[model samples]
Target: MRHADVAQIVHTIAVETNTPEETVARMYADTLDSYRADARIHDYLLLFAERKVRATLRGGNSNRH
Candidate 1:
């Protein structure tokens, strides 16, 4: 995994859990297995989803078909 992904995960979990960095980090490292494996796997989904979103947005710039 990329450092970017880990950083994003850390920041996002901080916002979501509304906890201190230490607690959120500990939870992420220790209790992620409390979630399904797909929870971790789906972290990669943002890459494709962002690409699709950008493509859609770019397509919108064309007023003509």
Candidate 2:
């Protein structure tokens, strides 16, 4: 994903969850890295990372898809 796309996702998630942008950005970067490690297809990495971060901030399990 582009840097601007990543930034937009971070901003959206932070606003939606009422979390700090710094916190969301960190979460996004960590989640993206984790996905990158095992990913064969790069198409949805950002989307999956965004969802995972959102789920995490909302008190959901990070282990789920």
Candidate 3:
């Protein structure tokens, strides 16, 4: 995925999980750098996974539809 997309995911997770975006992203980046293609973080990249992201990021400002 593009770094921007990954960034969005990180931001989504941070907002939902109440963690710092930088910290969450760094954890993924560092893990990806370590595991390369073996990164488990990819699970969050799937279509359904985006639901969690969207649900978290979804405020009254935007609609998923």
Candidate 4:
């Protein structure tokens, strides 16, 4: 995802989860980085990272969605 897209995701998630934007962005970045490290394809990295971040913020696991 582009920086702007990721920023928007972070903002939206923060608002939706009542979490701080900084926290969401941090988690998103970390999740994306982790995924990128082992990913063979880049197409779905952003989507996966976003889902993981959301799940984590919701007190769930990355396996949620």
lDDT tens digits, residue span 11-32, model 1: 7655654656565455455434
Clashes of each: 0, 0, 0, 0
| TM-score per candidate, chains pooled | 0.40, 0.89, 0.52, 0.90
* RMSD of each predicted structure: 11.6, 1.1, 8.5, 1.5
lDDT of 4: 0.88
Question: Which pairs clash (backbone N, Cα, C closer than 3 Å) in model 2?
Answer: none
The model with the greater TM-score, 2 or 3, is 2
What does candidate 4's lDDT look like per residue over 1-65, in tens digits? 47888889999999999999999999988888999898888998889998889888889867743
Q: State the lDDT of candidate 2 residue by residue for 5-55, as single tens digits.
A: 889989999999999999999999988899999989989888889899999
For candidate 3, write residues 1-65 as lDDT tens digits: 78788878778778877878877666656544544455556554343344434453444322231
- Candidate of highest lDDT: 2
Model 2: weakest 10-residue lDDT segment is 56-65
Q: Give stretches of model 1 more than 4 Å off.
A: 32-65
Worst 10 residues of 4 by lDDT: 56-65
Error of 2 at 13 (Å): 0.4
